[model samples]
Target: ISLLQDEHELARIVADMPWSKIDVNGLREQETRIRRQIERIENDPELGQLQTELKQLNQQATAENRNQYQAEDDLDKAQHAVQAEQAWLDAYGNDDFDDATLSSMVSNLLADAYENCFGASVRAQDRPKLIAGLFDHESETPFHTRALRNIVRIARTRIQEIDARSNQLRADTERIMDDYLNNHSTDDNTVMASVEDYRYFLDELDELNMLVTRAATDEEYANSVKKLYMSFQQLNRALRTDEENIKEQLNRINSMLKGQQFGPQGGRLSLDVTFSPIDRQFETTLSRILSKLEDWTRNASDNPTETRNAFNNCETFVNRLHNELDKIHDTNGIKAYGARNLDPRVRSSFYAIVHHDNAPDERISSTGGKSGGALQELTSFVYGAALIYLLGGDLTARPTYTTLFLDEALIKADGRYTKRALAVLPRLGFQIIVSAPESKTAEILNVANRAYVAYKDPSTDNSYLQELDSETITQDETQPTTAPAKPTTEA
Candidate 1:
């Protein structure tokens, strides 16, 4: 255990060490293999014992290693370069990624291209998932395929609790978003977010509903899922025509591939005007053609001359298909992509607040006199969901929103309302405060870490509202006290 810990720690330090000064590439493989062997030592106990035997062997190898190690060795220089670069990155917060200074920093960071020096670090804690995510997200789809794969597993896990009410709500939302476009096909601006909104919400609902079906082994995870599901209820639903969007895309692509009508100027395959829904067909066909062309030369040659001609034809076909795929465009200039947008403004360090604080409000106009308060509330709710996402929970679930200052709402929400709300806060990791004439806020504050009260001093000539900071103190000296919650750190 001691050797393993020390080696792992050394690996981290070496991995972080700047490579600019350590110019040798020869020892790189050895260094990496050593780390991998150490990790496997834990998995294979026999290997652990072997490592002890190998320990002495490695020292002997090192002694003989210097015999082959010539003066000004590359590995020795690389080690020094890596250490120097580490100090440089440390001086620059490890990421001088801003515009004005970014290029200079990046050029310096990537100076050792021969060594394939990457400034990134895979900290010991994140090594496993970091490697796995890299492998899962290897292709062009980025995280989408991985997400899609995960969505199924997650949905199946929570399939049971998707009760009739939830299903109906989802179905209704889907229908309004799809066939009707929020029941306002004639009016575009009348709708706020589009069909995409509904699809994403439905996806979230499906994921959470499944989670709710089973008894979540982790309480925190369960609460997070529930919070997300409740928040998802506030989103626009595009109700899908069917449950298989991926299948639909594939079918359309296959259909378009079959429909490739060849004949006119340079044999251009004109797209059918009615091909609105089946656009994926064109893309899939081109991709397939490109893929087949790569193997054209691998086939046995009929005659050398005949084979050369065939290869040329195949190359021409591949090039044309590539050009056609490049020409393909969406009306909105959209392109095929996975959904892993990481807009910083939409997130904060540790808080992901759901929309402004209402149920889904689908109102179109602020100018309309009859416009409801629901939209405003829904907007707040969306912001709240963004907050949840920002805070590292599923967007469909709520995080620590229980730290609510329900000044007026508490008076209206009776005991049961307050009870359920209070119950949820602790589960979701929230603290609640209600400004009621009764001591509701005070009551909860007693169990809280810290609290404050504000009042207007009317006795003075000029009245000003001032807040008096308050701290929670123990009433019992003999009882063991719970530790206060600390502010969360970003993942």
Candidate 2:
């Protein structure tokens, strides 16, 4: 059992051994065969030659191993060079160089470098030689890299200078803007800094400059003065003519009023027009300018001293006239300066004067002291005379029938005054139509040849008119005695 136990341990140890399954008899037979072959080779006569050949073959195998290693290393270096060249091409090559030749690629690179360094493109022929010189150590201009560095340095210096100048300009602009805003600040602390405000200021400056230039010479100033003087003369003549026309019309109206008889005393009426200057200073200056202009015209060529004095006087008067005009706030005053007489500066007052054969002359303007009937009679004569003045044309010619319509007129007048007032219009060739209330119907009809009654329908809220014969009316009848069934015409 002990031997069997040891034998089992040995079998287990053999199973664990690395080479426990070796064929020992085959190994011994291979060792005997190898020694027998070696002995036979050493003893044979061709052994030396065979040994020499074997040694030579071993040397050849060693050389071939060394050559294989060198070739592998060279191939790795070539691969690395190819990868590096491909990366360089990716960095610098353009799509334009996709099918280009190697010479073209080198020329393009040189051209790009030259343009970048010198800020200009080189010719194609110059590119190759420049590229060759960049890489050639023997060339005099081999400092292309230094030149590029210098260009970069110059660009940086210029950029810094531009930045400094820009900052200075910005500071100056801000300072100027602040100063302008401060100077032009308004009462509300607002600045008129808009482009339009600046433009308007510039325009005003230009106009002032133009005026200054225009009057810089004495001859130019004289010419301007002459123009202004002539304008003033023309305007004065126009205004005087307008004033004469107005006076003539007033005279014609006065003539018509003189023929009319008013009240029981047969009073005559007249309109009085008075002239007064709106601006006394402006008129005085204008008159002085006119006198100076006349003097200048009369003695300008004859006497130099008189011409100069006249011109100076005219200029002074013109300046005063301009100042006075500036002070004038009336629209008519300004229009008069432009020769447009919308409102004549002369103020006119109309007065109805009564010329009675028995009593002293009285002015109708004092209506506060007069009776309402007397005032009404006087106004009616004045109005009838004004109508005749407008429509009578020539007073000497025979009159034509012109209709005058009066609504509720002469109601405050007594019967005698109302009759006289109503007769005044018909005598002036006016056919009068009087519309009065029922209370004044008797007074109105005393002189009316025809009358009309206005009636309103309560249901329809419409008004209508009915004509009446004057013979049918009586002093006792206030309302219409009869009205037509339907309206003669709508009112």
Candidate 3:
């Protein structure tokens, strides 16, 4: 019984990793793949449905062999699950359970767990520590009433510590190597100093790992490992925060760009930006500016003529700054955005115009509503284009940005226009990071060397943005949205 209990617990633990990472899609995909791989029994396939059934039966037979030993630990946990399920089922069915029936049900469930989980399933016998897993039993032994739980735990605990140490050693090696490469210089002394520093950090990490692995007991190892884990958390936080000010600076520049006054009531291509974070939902103020610009472009008669000149002059300076900043960073990641410049669509064609037409807004005009929706589209386009144009161009460049992001970029465009607009991106230039979600196409994934998915946690008012890789990259920041006041009455 104790041995069977141990097997149940092991089986339960074995399932932990795959479950945490695999969601519905992954599971469904795996199931489908298995289904395809298994040929019908009628086909005389090498690995068919019959083969699967055979393996399952083999497992059942082995489990039955262990049943005579009465592995109590596994049986207990299995009994617990079975009892819980039975209680629910009985209640639903308006039935009552007797002791014999209950015991039989528990035993049957235990047998199933033994068969399915390779007889290593955790069971109710491990409830001693309440390990949170389904098969965790309260006591160690169920096979024949020996205190086997402690003995196995002691062994597992030691093994876990050693595993941690080995992983830490690998991390140290990578960190040391990355540091050595990053700090490598043309000067011999500088290179040697960097190499020495890298080596020192590696030695420090290795020593700590060794200490953890060599600790006298699992408890000692756990305590020591907590300190190491905390240290790692600190390092990861530091790395994430290090030199992130560049994005903030860019945001500020964007704010200034947003502040640039386009045409007033009646102008050609007026652009007043409403600056918001990449995750911000809408730029209300910017929307109004876009509305006004659109109106002016479309209603030139209503706009102030002087307003058009001021807007033009402001844009000239804005374009120059944008170009200069573009020089500082490689916007290769969003190359697709700017790819097909002379596209037939008005939006794409006009956006291409912004790329080369850096003149002040006075020369550009929407007199008598001739400018059309060009003003609004160009406003979003320039910012979007600037982002696309500035992403690190060399997909292979180390230390380059791993992601590119923009929020609510396609605010007002219709489906056809948006589709046409997005098509231009792949042709633009480079793709180093993975930030933007292109329309309906995972095809982009094929070309991307890497991709990132970012989102805020839903549990709190304070937005905690987390990346898919389990790293907290930024603070709890709210996505910017269009202020309620801005109205785009396009009647």
Q: State each model's CA lDDT, in order.
A: 0.43, 0.67, 0.43
Candidate 2 on 4-36: residue-level lDDT in tens? 999999899778878857777997999999999
Better of 1 and 3 by TM-score: 1
* Most TM-score-accurate candidate: 2
Q: Tell me the TM-score of model 3.
A: 0.17
| Model 1 lDDT, full chain set | 0.43
Give the lDDT ranking, best first: 2, 3, 1
What TM-score should be assigned to candidate 2? 0.44
Query: For residues 255-315, could you state the per-residue lDDT of candidate 1 as single tens digits?
Result: 3223221211112111111112323553454344434333432452324443344344445
Judged by whole-model lDDT over C-alpha atoms, candidate 3 comes out at 0.43
Q: Which regions in candidate 1 have their CA more than 4 angstroms from the true location?
A: 1-281, 287-291, 294-372, 393-491
Best by lDDT: 2
Q: For each candidate in turn, give its C-alpha RMSD to the true structure in angstroms.
A: 40.2, 28.7, 40.6
TM-score of model 1 vs. true structure = 0.20
